[model samples]
Target: MSTYFISDIHGCYREFKILLKKSNFDVKKDYLWIAGDLVARGPNSLEVIRYLYSIKDRTNIVLGNHDLNLIAVYSGIKENKKENYFDDFLSSKDSDKLINWLRSQSILKINEQQKIIMIHAGISSQWDFETMKACALEIEASLLSNDYPLFLKSVFNNKINYWNSSLRKIDRLRYSVNAFTRMRYCYPNGKLNLICKKSPNVVKYPLLPWFIISNKFKEKYSVVFGHWSTLKDTRVPSAFFPLDKGCCWGGQLLMLRWEDKQYFYQSYLG
Candidate 1:
């Protein structure tokens, strides 16, 4: 059985199926790792979640920014005031189960045997695997616990990027969520620059992508991540990689065979 890693599906259920087929996925024999963003931005999110949930035992998913956004919108963390593109997921026949499944996913998946590191957005350099896992688990508890709605609502409204262990849980929750999901660039002092969504090399400030800035993780592991939709088919410097090919924007969906780094891509049909 081959090991496959995918990311940033973004609710394009059709694209996902196409990629699954193109990759010749062997559900019983192969391991599938998803780097999150499994919902929102396209059509038929509920179907996507249901299908993945049905195969939960064979799947590994990390939460993407859009995935968390959908949860936030549903749980009243952020306003559902924007586009109602994912209304089907919110008003679906199985919204509860779908949301529950999404909330149950992790923010990072590491397999030392494969030497593969998976995450939605890139992890900050200051974060070693242990620190990253701690932050992710904290938010996971918030999403699954009794104060879930409160956690969701507060996760996106605060100042993201600051890292203060002395900060309250609420503030800490917001920073952790953003860094693990929404962050792109940051300063050397571990201050996040959430304003720029463009490539790291061309940023106005001298800041770099979290991984690059940290200089600690370059080539340390085979990192697989999704979320920067513009990174489709592009390779980053220092063995950094991006796999979110913007399938929701009518781009290609991508999958990587972890053992050999073999790749498969299919056009989005959403």
Candidate 2:
């Protein structure tokens, strides 16, 4: 039984299906770990979510920023923007079922046997495994709580853009969410730079990719993450693996077989 990791599928349902068929994924034996952004941007968000929902038992997903935004919009905590592509999904009869299941997903997962960590985005350089797990659990609890809508509403307004163990309540949760779902570049001191979305080569110095600046946990565990599609080429950090190949942006969708570290790709045809 193999375990495959993929990320940033956006809404390319056809490509998702093709990739699965090409890989000959066996649902009963092999497991799938999605780094997230399972929907949005492409043409078939509704179908994509429905397909994933059908295979929920065999799939492990960590929520990405777009997925969280979908929840916020569904919960009436945020306004849906026209540029965002989920109208079909929102109008579908199974919308509620899909949204609820997506919300129930986690922001981080750890495979101790493989010595790997899966997150939608990078974790803070300052946090160790225990602290990262604790912070993630705090947000997970809030998302699963009865007042989750309230939590979503509060998360966006707080400007606590850095990680601090002393941060309490909403501020703490918001920081954790951003780090796990939206982070790319951050200062060496663990202060996040949320606006720079360009490739790391073009990004000015002093602002480093989270993986490069994150020293405390460097080389400690293998990290598989998505969210920054602009990162085209892979790195040799030995611990950092970025799988978002920008399939929704006319690039290829990538999957990594964790056991052998081999990659498979499907080009965007939509």
Candidate 3:
């Protein structure tokens, strides 16, 4: 069975399905890895969630920032923005079920056998695979816990750049969520910038892309991520694979076949 990776779909249901068709993805035989942002922005967010849930057993997903935002909004911790276009998704009868499934997804996915790691955004340089996994697991656990709404409330709008073992439990969880789903740039010393969303070439000073600062990890394993659409076509090492091509912004949906490292694309249909 072939494995394919795609990310930052952002509810572009038509484009997503087109990409799958373009790549000849066999639902019964092939596996799919999604780097998240499964909803928001584009039209048909509800349909995207329904389809993904139906094939969940054959899919691997890491929660993205928009996914987390949807969860928080559903839980009444955050206000839903109209620009996210989540009205139908939130109003659906299956909204609760879909949101629960989303909450159950981890922030990071690792295939040790293949030496591949997938996250929504960039990995923290301070975190080795073990540390990253531990942090991700913690966030997963929190989301699954009875106090998940409280957990989401604690993490909302909170940003933690540096990792400290002595941090409070809530703080640690917040850091993990942000690092896995929203991070973009990092300071020279490995602290996350979390602000500048511009392309690396346009950004200077002490800030560098998180992948650049965490090159050591990339050298050991292929790091696949999406959150940064502005990262389009920025050449990096072979170990780094960025799949988000701004499909929600009228670009194209991109997918990578792991076996041959082949890239597939489907232009935005919306």
Candidate 4:
């Protein structure tokens, strides 16, 4: 059986399905790893979530920022934004079930056998792989806990840009969530630059792509991430793979066959 990695579905269900067909993905045999953002921006958030839920056994997912926001909106912690186009999804009868499933999903996944790490956004330059994994699990625990609504309500803080082990539990969780779902750029000293969403080339120095900064993790793993569609053609090291092709914004959807690293693209028609 083969494995595939893709990200930032953004409710582009048509393109998502077409890309899978184009890649010859076999649900029974091939495993699909989704870096997340299963909803928002496209016309079929409901369809996208339903299909993923149907095939969840064959798929592995990590929650993206949009996905987390969807959960927050559903829990009444945040309002549903019109631009996100989540009405159909939120109004669905299965919305509660879907959101619960999403909450149970983790923020990070590691395949030790393949030496691959799958996350929605970039990793923190200040955290080693083990620390990253630990922080991710901590967030996952919070998400799945009974107090998840409270967690969602407090998780969006951007004030804590730097990672500190001694920070309060909530602060640490928020930082880890941002690092895993919203991060793009980092200051020279390893602080998160969460406000900037532009591509790396256009941004001046001291605000480099998170991957460009050094971390304590040994150079043995490849990080497969999504969430920064603006990264577009920005070339990163071979160890870092970005799969967001901006499909919901009139761009194409991309899928990478993990076995051979072959990429498949499906241009958006809607």
Candidate 5:
């Protein structure tokens, strides 16, 4: 069985299906790993969720920032902004079921046997795999708890841009989520530069992509990540694989077959 990894689909269900067909993906024999941003900014967010849910057993997903935002909006913790692209999903009869399933997904997926890790964004240099997994579980627990809506309400309000084990509960969870999902650039000291969405070449001094800052971890394992569309290409300094080819922004939907490291693409149909 082959494992295929894709990221930043952003609700382009048509292109997603096209790529699957092009790759000759077998639902029963192949496994699909999504790096995240499964829904948002495209025309068919609802359809994407439903389709993935139907194939849930064969799919592994890490929650992206957009996925978290969808949860917050669904739970009434955040406003549903115009560009968010979740109206159909929110209005659907299966909204609660879909959101619940989404909430159950982790922010980090580690395959120890393959020595590969998948996340929506990059992990911090400060964390080894075990430590990162522990932090991810902390946030996942909150997401799965009875007070998840409260957790969502509090998660986005904090400015704890750095990691500290002594941080309060909410702060710790927020920091973990940011590092696993929203982070792109960070200072050499590992403080996240959450505002700079530009490519690494254009960013000013003292800021580097999280992978560049976390060289040690990069050397140890292959990492699959998305969420930074401006990355422009998939190559980085280490075994880091970037899959967000900006499909939501008129680029191509990309997939990497993990066994042989083959890359496949299906361009935007618009």
Candidate 6:
């Protein structure tokens, strides 16, 4: 069976459905890898969540920023902003289950058999595969635990630049979440740049996209990531695959078929 990687649904139930049907998704056969953003910004957050839950057994997911925010809103740690979608989700009968399931997702997944590593956002250049797996597990466990609300509120803030081995647990939790879910650009020395969300050329510093930064692990590793939908889809061979295509901005939702090469499908959010 073929394997596919899809990213940045952003609550577009229509697009999601279109992609699923058009791809001939077979729950028993083809594997579906979701690069996350399972909710927010579209008109069908609740429906999308419901649908995914119905087929949850067949899908493997990594949490995206919007998905994490949805989890926070559902858990009462963060209130839903008016601009943000998901009122229907907040008012749903199964809101509690939905929140738990969302939080249960991981920030990265690697399939050794397929030679694929999927992350919601880029990983730090400083981290190798083993380090990434370790850090991802630590963050995932924290998200799935009872202390997640505290993790979301105090420690989830991204302003912290200093990380120490002796830092408090909450601080470590926050750092892990940011590093896994929110990383985009990173300085040459690996400091995360959270403010600049534009494309790479817009930046003037030596800082660059996290995967582009030279590191001990560079040139020998493969990375597949989403987020920064501005990068859209690049023709950068398989060294780096960016699967987010701005579906939330009325652009197309993208899916990469990641076996022989990168076959793909798209659904316009218009």
Q: Which candidate gets the maximum TM-score versus the true structure?
A: 4
Model 1 / residue 206 / CA error / Å: 1.3
lDDT value, residue 109 of candidate 2: 93
Output the lDDT of residue 188, model 2.
Answer: 71
Alpha-carbon RMSD, candidate 2:
1.4
Q: What does the lDDT come to for candidate 3? A: 0.88
**Candidate 4 lDDT tens digits, 62-116:** 9999999999899888988898898988888988898899999989988889988
Please write out the lDDT profile of model 1 over residues 113-178, one tens digit for every residue.
766778888776667667777888898888789878877766775365778778788887888888
Go through the candidates in order and give the C-alpha RMSD of each one to the true structure: 2.1, 1.4, 1.1, 1.0, 1.2, 2.1
Off by over 4 Å in 2: 234-236
Q: Model 3 segments beyond 4 Å from truth?
A: none
TM-score-better candidate, 1 vs 5 = 5
lDDT (10s digit) by residue, model 3, range 185-264: 88888887777899877888788888877446766788899999998858777888988889899998999999999999
**Residue-by-residue lDDT tens digits, candidate 6, 19-107:** 87777777778878888788888778889878888878878899988888887787788888975787888998898998888888878
lDDT of 5 by residue, 135-200 (tens): 999989999999999998888843778988788878888888889989998899989878888887
1-270 per-residue lDDT for model 2 (tens digits): 999999998989899899988887888899999998887788887888888889889998999988888899889778878756877878888898888888799989988888889999889887877889999999888888989899988887436778778888778888898889988988878788888898976778789889887465556678899998898863537788899989999999999988888898999996
| Alpha carbon lDDT at 208, candidate 4 | 92
After superposing candidate 5, which stretches have Cα over 4 Å from the reference? Answer: none
**Winning model by lDDT:** 4
Q: 4 or 5, which is superior by lDDT?
A: 4
User: Which window of 10 residues has the lowest lDDT sum in candidate 3?
Assistant: 211-220
Clashing pairs in 4: none
Pairs clashing within candidate 6? none
C-alpha positional error of residue 215 in candidate 2 after TM-score superposition, expressed in Å: 3.6
